[model samples]
Target: MSRRGQRLTHLELLERLVSFDTESSKPNLALMDVVCDYLEGWDVPFVRVPNAAGDKAAVFATIGPMVDGGIVLSGHTDVVPVAGQAWTTDPFALRIADGRAYGRGAVDMKGFCALALAAVPDALAADLRRPIHILLSYDEETTCLGVADTIARFGADLPRPGAVIVGEPTGMEVADAHKSIVTYHTTVHGHEAHSAKPMLGANAVMAAADLVSELNRIADAMIARGDASGRFDPPATTVHVGTIAGGTARNILPKVCTFHWEFRGLPDLDMGEIPALFAAKVAAVTRERLNRYGEFGRIETVEEVAVPGLAPEPGSEAERLALRLAGRNHTISVPYATEAGRFQEAGIPTVVCGPGSIDQAHQPDEYITLAALDSGAGFMRRLIGECGAP
Candidate 1:
């Protein structure tokens, strides 16, 4: 590690990383550059996969020799926005209060990333037989774009890791499966007239309300018929409408209404059915309205993002290796989604284990306990030793 004293302390690294404000809406190039410099200092060869806009990028660094099967240490570089969060201190500045490092990404992530970087020196100094890959991705908070690029590189330009550990905030718990996230933005178009002349104009808000009711019905039905996999909480898919916008004035009929909704699906649940059901409901509702109005009304659903869920594969090498390395006999399921599923879908075996508690993630004044950091560091040390890195 660092001769200065086993690299920087976790809090120190957290402070530096938190100061960068790598929010999902903004570019993370500055933070990526800093990480690149640290890797280069250790003589690690890395490649940059920049986004099409060239504003943000993912950094992939390989330690040990290039090989067919290695371990990929993955973490997202982005943090959620601090907008409207009632923080006691600056959200971008790490504040240690009551034995906690309070900051936007201290618990959600960045802490794990910092710990991985801190362990880099130790990994670099070891004699290694197989490679240890550091996979830092960007835009994970936005749409899971960065990990997708990293996964696409596997077995082609990139050496596919035998196992991938997604370092999300899971309190060092080994998560084998989680729900998938699918977000949709829907718009409804209707003719507008004076509110007093309700008969003369189609009401967009009314149509949106009908659609939302249908969504709720669909969600209830899914819950009643739970998925076969009993791993997930609620044991089924869940749908929620998060945001809605419509009329500008109470006196005027709304011409357009829009809403954002999402669904978290169990691993075995098919997401395609959700939209299809909604579409069928919308078609029926709109057909009735069109027949009444002698005109057509429009309802459009646009997919904002879709993140797949991790399906438990029995006798999978990924799970077997993770259990062996983590010294755990069983795998647990998490409610949150990670890049693990994306990696698994790319034909790469993946597991989820990391520092910090999911309870602290995305909350005001978030923190990762020092004990979590220590445990994660130890995990990395063992991983490097097992990989035969010197």
Candidate 2:
């Protein structure tokens, strides 16, 4: 096909992908169906690694010779919710105007998916000595664990690739480092009493307030510690409280109160440090505040999601390959976390490089510029050339 025809195909595939509301909360099986069918048309060998519940799956497709020392292109199939965002165009329907394509996942991801799938023909024609693998995973916006089962199969029933490139919108600039994110939900249990009674029951709301204040103190300490490497924005690990709710009436001592919070840590920071500090505070708060009224209440914390950080691996195969394909000499650090760390943890060298600007991701009327899409196509072409070499 001609160059123009290939670009058109790429846009069409993106349109199809965006049409599916593969929100992190919903199942991505429908989107996987379309992807599997496309790979089938190309005669690409692929595998479906489904979640334990079997409601969703990750599709791993291979082109050229199925062997070790290949390249893996990874992207998540899930997009964030759009319920409250004010979008000029339909968030799930692809709309092209002013040299850009607008959609929810167009820039955050799906764009790279289109570019990779569009190169299926070229990858086949390249007669590559090293295989090119495309991995579409689920739940990256939430847990980042959707790739775990597939990564586990590498070298067992599947060929383990030498490097992995997570296609998260980095404006085609290679990224080698990012922060880790862990989310938590804390609940305070207390006994109910009338507002007139001071010592009869513990105040859950007051206890929750103390915890939130402690979290702020922790956030301040994290800021003071700062990023030692000077690569992270905000220049420090960030602690945030997203939501808090509790209480029945203003006059009553609430029986339960819950708050949601998270901390994004620098790659070099010890992951256990923050949690340990919080645990100590929880103990103190439980003793001094919640149970001061003779075991009238307790505090409980549950970890919801923990996504590891991607550290800089300077001379790694993934970094070198991505930098070369992207026509750059150095790598960058993305402030956001991604599934790239999962690959690195599996012992595969990994980097993040893809089309479009992350500045457009997750916002209302999100878009990927046409020029960026074309640039991504160029990157894939060069990769095909590299893998095709004898």
Candidate 3:
């Protein structure tokens, strides 16, 4: 395809992709259908790694030699929900104006997906020495486990790639490090009693408040410790509470309270450290607050989501290749969590480099500029040259 043709095809694919309402809570099989069909039209072989429930899937396709030492281009198909956002146009409909393409996933990921798909013909025409694999997964906005099943297949039923480039909205910067995210839900169980009753029952709401306060103290400590490498923007591993619910009436001691909390850890921070501190606080809260009157209350916590961080691999293949292709000399760290960590955990060197700014992602009118898209296309072309016949 000519340059114009490629640009047109990229926009067309982005339009088609953004049409599907593949929110994190919804199934993305429909969007996968369009992707699979496009690959099929080019006679490209791919596999679908479906979730355990079979409602969603991750598609993996290889272009050129399917042997080892290939590069993997990874992107997620799911976008955040648009139900509560105020949009100037339909969130699912692609709109182009002012040199920007607007839609829910256009920048957050679908832009990179479009660029990779558009390069399929170019990759095939290169008759490359090594392969270029494209992986599209689900649930990145929520669990980030959509690629787990597919990653598990590497070196078993699938060919392992030499490096991975996760196409997150990094504005074409090569990101070698990112934070890890772990979410949790805590529930305080207490006995209900009349407000006038003293030493008769434990108050769940009060106990939950104490726990939240403890978390605040822990968050302060993390802030003081700061990021050792001084690469992160916030400069610290941070903790937050998203929601809290409890208490039926003002006159009665609440029987149950629940809250959702999470921590985004710096790459060097121990993953177990936050949980251990929170557990100790929970124990103390249960003993001193929840069950002060008797053994009338208890606290329980469940780990909900755990997404690992991407540590800096200064001289790794992914960093070197991505920086070279992106026309850059230095690497930066993103505060967001991405599936690149999953690839890193699988012993694959991985980096995050893609089009569009993270600022445009998850907003009411998410967009990717034409200039950024063009730059991404150039990057793809250079990648083809690297793996092409030499």
In TM-score terms, which candidate is top? Answer: 3
Query: For candidate 3, what is the TM-score?
Result: 0.97
Instruction: Quote the lDDT for 279 in model 2.
Output: 92
lDDT of each: 0.83, 0.93, 0.93
RMSD of each: 2.4, 2.5, 2.3
- State TM-scores per candidate: 0.93, 0.96, 0.97
Model 3, span 1-390: residue lDDT tens: 223223247888899999999999999998898788788878888999999999999999999987988999999999999988999999999999999999999999999999999999899899989999999999999989999999999998889999999999888899999999999999999999998994789899999999899899999999999988989989999999999999999989999999999999999989999899989988898888877779999989999999999999989999999999999999999989999999999999999999999999999999999999999999999999999998
Give the Cα RMSD of candidate 2: 2.5
User: CA lDDT of 30 in candidate 3?
Assistant: 88
- Deviation from native of the Cα of residue 302 in model 1, angstroms: 0.8
Worst-scoring 10-residue span by lDDT in model 2:
1-10
Clashes of 2: 0
lDDT of 1 by residue, 1-390 (tens): 233334666667778888898889899999888788777777788999999999999999998888769888899989888888888888888887666777888877898888778777777778678888889898888788787776788888888788888989776777889989999999988878888877777788888898999999988998899877777787889999999999878988788899999999988877788989999988976776522465746788899999998988766777787677677888889998888889988888788888889998887777877777788877887787787733
Please report, as a residue range, the 10-residue window in candidate 3 with the lowest summed lDDT. Answer: 1-10
Give one digit per residue, the lDDT tens place, for model 2 in 1-390: 123223347898999999999999999999998888788777789999999999999999999888888899999999999999999989999999999999999998999999999998899888998999999999999899999999999998989999999999999999999999999999999889997995889999899999899999999999998888999898999999999999999999999999999999999889999899999988998999888878799999999999999999999999999999999998899999999999998899999999999999999999999999999999999999999957
What C-alpha lDDT does candidate 3 achieve relative to the native structure?
0.93
